[model samples]
Target chain A: MHRMMSDKRTIFLMMAPGFAVFFAIVFIPVFVSLFYSFTDWDGISAYRMVGLHNYRELLLHDPVFWKALRNAFLLGGAFLLIQHPLAVATAMILQYCGRAEKALRTILFIPSIISGFVTSKMWVQILSTQFGLLNRLLDAVGLSTWRQDWLGSSSWAIASIIFVAMWQGFGYAFLLYYTGVKGIPQDLHEAARLDGATAWQLNTRIVLPLLQPVIRTSIILAFIAAFKQMDTVYLMTQGGPDNSTQFLATYLYQKAFSINLYGYANAISVLFIIVCLLVTAALNRMGRQEVGEF
Target chain B: MARANPAMNRKSPLGWPFGIVMAAFAAIQLFPLLWLVDYSLLKSSQFFGASILIWPKPAQWANYRIAFTAGHIPRYLTNSLVVAAVTIFLTVLLSMMTAYVLTRMKWRLSSFFYTLLVVGLIIPLHATLLPNFFIFKQFHLLDSYGALILPYVAFGLPFCTLIFCGFLQTVPRALEEAAVLDGLSVPGILVRIMLPITRPAIATVSVFSFLSSWNEFIMALTYVRSELYKTLPFSLLQFTGQYSSNYAAQAAVMTVIAIPSVVVYLLFTDQITSSISHGSVKG
Candidate 1:
């Protein structure tokens, strides 16, 4: 049996197809991207090696890169500060809603499952300056003064993007928290109740503390999602209104496809990957340290 | 369950507020799609009316017909379905085989290979886009379904393999040992026994792969230029250009694009949600 299981030929045959595709399609491209990042390829002309020049320009000279970086961080921060807390609070409330729990959870998760294209298109209509549902509703409610071009104006584009993104993503965040809340052993809630702890105390003092691991994971996932945001931004604004809503992925795309600066785009992608890894690593370290304390 | 938490009991003072809050949030979550559907049934002129929502006295279902014919939705939808179906099939099959080899077989570099594959979860797809474009261009695969399908399957494998590996580890070795004693070959055991056991994981992987591939926009946008190979999401971009002022028709196109994913989610909600939590937490 052991021999059969460990037969080198069979094992090799089983692994070869997946490994070949993965390497050809994903693994090799990553290395190729890294290689391209050091050159000055303009997609049309013969490329010349210019070691460190692309990164140097991207790091020190590019204001748009800085803005995209800042905007990505802002999106990440909003996910952590705004979206996560609301999701948690909603999850906490839903946990106590006896029969309606599953239905509500399903409804909340619907947004996350739909295509980003659909979400962006829907929001674009809702936020349109002339025929927007939002502004129209605001007028009906006598708040017409508050109307603004949600996706067109520079001041509101990023915030609108963030809002649409948060709306689209709220379901997944809510689901994570809901599952975490459900996974909390019933005894914890019972024990707290027996000790005469108020519901608020039971959640804050007991439930929240026990939810540390899920919270850490959720935060990490949120940051990854935020940094990786491109589809919605691309569909809605394409980082328009003079690049007001630029994200890392969209900016890299614009540089590569639109402007034909393949080398600089590759440099941006490499840094993008590094930024994601660093953020994930930092959060993981913090999580481990906190776990050590307990 | 209701008796387990008195606060959640219907008779409790907090019940009404909790129900209201949950209902309100559910409404907020669902209203946008409902409104989209509503507007899709209205005439284009009615879209700018004073009311935020108008019940179409007579529904403009023609918008859907126009979207289907004029918007080139059938071609895009066919492309999307073919790409997604092929991607899901290949990803599930390859990942299952790879998972079995990595977990059940004793090999010197199994752990190394497993780590390498699992690390793909963090590598953003943007990093691969440019290189992949050139690679596809070299192979003359641009404007072909293979261009989208290959990368989709490649990116889908890591997560699917991870899920399958997690599932495979939990299956006891006794069943496989029994199969071996019954004179079953390794491939037979894998096919007849392991595949049956991993159905839940397969469902999870299929849904994940389908969602990723079916709604994939950037790769399709980059690799496929001709309308012949464009996927469903591309229809919206084209509709935005072609029917730029036809708001109702555009809404119809958007609705059509969103329906398949919504249907899949409805069918596999439990598997999808559970797999997401399991996959991400473990990942």
Candidate 2:
């Protein structure tokens, strides 16, 4: 027993595989990215240290970087202002939905379950300038004047992207809020009802207050998701119509793979890491505030 | 408006509004997918001319055949399956082992290592992109299964480990004590006693990692350049790019790529919801 207790080798053996793989794939590469960010390593070239030159250029000179950041913030705001509230309300309504709850939840979540590629391509077709479903529906409803290029035009591009992103994410948010709502003790609602609490009052005061933790979680996740937004935008428009819908991920990919600007891309990546970590830390700090007395 | 009524009537008046909202959202949710399926069976001309609400008169089943044969969807499907299966196996095993150590063992660096693992969760994959590309290129692993599987396993480790660690902590210490009395080693105890009990956590992690890897795009797109090695998402993206004008074939490819994931979701809907909510709340 003593020998077994003292055996460090087994513990090391157990930790070795996961740590090695994680280090090689995730950890070491990030530091390598940091190092490369300070150099001019363009795929094939033997490069010398540029030492923050890439960072300076990306921060000071790049209009597209600011555009991407702005779009990401817009999407994040939509998640908070539009998606989360809608998800919570739907989840609340779903509780009262009785028999159709499971089916409705499943239907709402289906978009989330499908691949981004399929969703983006399908939306592209549905947003076709001439024969899109949105346009055709408008025509059918005698609102043909509203029909326009949804994904093609610069004006509607970001909103269209946000709508698709929100659609894809709606299910997960609903499920999260639904699960949170379900976790609330039933007797509280019963007691509230017995005390003459109205439905709106019950939800706002009792259920929603109890769901603050879940809401915080959903907000943080939605923000990070918006920040990391790439796949749908890449497939749908490739940040097109003059980079109108550019995102950090897509822009980084374009800079690296498309144009062979590995050093410049790495610099963008360093900022990307900083932004993600700061957002996460900030949210965590904010969530550390007063715990509800309930 | 009295809240003192029986539960049925108290909720009954608002039922219509809730039902209407749910039905409307469900319709909105389903419209794009239904349109995709509808458009997958039509020629481009037919697709452009047909009413958006209407189905094709004569469905073009050949699109499926063409997508499968000419578009190399079967190849992509097989590649996705292989990569996802292997990645799931490795991720679950590695996560279980790591979690077992972190929770059950008395290692000095456990917290530090655990923090390290958690950092993987927050590090944007885009940040890792160029370095991974360079490393893989150096190792001559580009356009290969290794490139995909390694990154998949690595990125998947954090969340899976978190889930497994949460589950492992709940396992009664008495079981391990009994195993120790019977001369079982730590690994043996993990294999014999812990693995069986952690089945649900394993299932959750497997489902999540599998789905993510199957639907993964950026890594597959950046690392793999060969048509022979592309996964479903990458293949679909490439096929759509090549045939941007052929809406039917693009839709067909999308449908073929989408079925596996949707079927997986249907099969594991309970696991997905339960596991994710469990992680979020506990996390």
Candidate 3:
């Protein structure tokens, strides 16, 4: 009892600021967004209660919401399938590389460290229709017909953007997998070789299984990144060409700030949170099986 | 798994070709950056020089001169510098306080506080978009450094606190207990005993907070409207104009904006790289 009194006071003092800032800024915003989702506020006008009306419209009436959600899913799916594998492959190759390893790692990591704005601008120049490098290169290679306005065309815009994102992000995911792969003992690989396993066989039966945790972590992170991505998207397309590349983050901004429909944006945010939660939970369930040991 | 004979030791089949392929990939990866340097160094006349090798004939070191010719960049760089400095100071302070208290205190609610910090991880920026707009407006802090700086500290505190808390967990408690027994006071123990032991964590937190605040764009875009109050990203975004559509100058602005993050990233790659690669995800 004597010890408890002083301990309680000190602990309270310690935990106060963290909880205070977080509860006020983060948690409060979450709940307020929920509350605002039911209103008819245009962000600057007097509010009116339209309980469940925004949600109703969003669930049944809105196509863009679904489209944005699907875009996020496409982004997430690409990260998991393409980016994650390439990150793993890059990291694995670098890890197996004997000399000049640090140089290679540093070189690979430069793109990740630069501002996304710079990379997006670079890609816009590269993928643009008239004077793009890709088109120029294609013309030089006698494959000029293969050239297209990657960012201008609606069909290819989202995919091209995803490709740029993956290209820039491959280093990060590669670093993650590289770190995890480096953690696995060299003895295990040698033992597998002693057991007469070929290179491909060892990778399939050993390295991949051991890397399940890393892979899951990579997928979850990549998915979350895909969902909240704004910087590159902001600069690259600005959710443009008739909202073809619009996402939840950008859409929320469009509704609340650009279009002045704060209440509806709040609804989108509420739903956005729910969808992210569901996706994360679903992934956790899928990744729940044991990451096997050597 | 067969440790192939080291490439240097054997002239294996396709060794040179494989080496060439990997080198080509590296070249492809670095080509755009090289192009960035190339463009930044070119005159408007020679800027679009046809040959990649022969381009940038006379390197215009003056592009850097033209970039800072009285605009938001200087102000933006200063604002970002102040914001980053203030953010690191306040966040590291708050993290130390929160981490120490949570670790040392004997309250039922300390665990809850720790959990709240964790949830801060999953709180997406979009979730807070509308509410914070209302918030800063009510506070009358729109387009001010206060508005930008305060939210940044709030966002960053959780991340640094997480690391500090984790670091605190690994620290032996006897030193803290000794300080307490010596009646040095709660604050004194943190300053005197805890801080010394947690130097690496603080260094990690400082580097991270500075880089993140310096690089962050979404909040700055949402909250900061006035060009006067804009940070580096904001400045770079609005650098391009309707008249000239100055791509070369914009590249210069991009270089200016890229400097602090790139320099800091390279300087503290060991810390930032390890921390980020540790997979403790935050915005």
Best by TM-score: 1
Sorted on DockQ, best first, the list reads 1, 2, 3
Window of ten residues with lowest summed lDDT in model 1 chain B:
B1-10
* lDDT for each residue of candidate 1 in B1-283, tens digit (9 for 90 to 100): 1134444553467766798888987998899899999989999999878987789879999999988887789888898989999999999999999999999999899999998886677888887899999999999999998999999999888888988988998899999999999999888998899889999999999999999897778888899999889999777676555578888988999889888888999999978887778755774
Cα lDDT for residue B259, candidate 2: 87
TM-score of chain A of 3: 0.93
Model 1 residue pairs with clashes: none
Ranking by TM-score: 1, 2, 3
Alpha carbon lDDT of residue B58, candidate 1?
97
In terms of lDDT, the poorest run of 10 residues in model 1 chain A is A285-294
User: How do the residues B1-283 of candidate 2 rate in per-residue lDDT, one tens digit apiece?
Assistant: 1122234234577777787889998998898898889888888777766377456778899888877765778788899999999999999999999998888777678899988877788888877888899899999999899999999999999988988988887777887888899999988988899889999898899999989998888899889999878888755555555575676777888888888889999999877887778656654
Interface RMSD of 1: 1.8
**Model 1's DockQ?**
0.67
> In CAPRI terms, where does candidate 2 land?
medium
lDDT of 2 by residue, A1-294 (tens): 446644689889999999999999988987888988999888887989999899999889999999999999999999999999999999888767766767898898999988887788788878878878888888878998998889889979888999999999998999899888877776787899889998889999999888988888778888888899998899888998899999999999899989999989998888998888888888888886565755
Superposition-based RMSD of candidate 1 using all C-alpha atoms, in angstroms: 2.1
At residue A89, candidate 1 shows an lDDT of 93
lDDT of 3 by residue, A1-294 (tens): 227335766766666775677677777888989998989999667999999999999889988888888888898899988878877776666544445555676677778877787778878877878766677778778898999988877778898878888888877887777667666777787688779886567677888888888788778878888887777777788787788888888888888888899899999999888887777778778777875565
TM for candidate 3 is 0.91
Highest-scoring model, lDDT = 1
> What is the iRMSD of the candidate numbered 2?
3.3
Off by over 4 Å in 1: A290-294, B1-7, B240-242
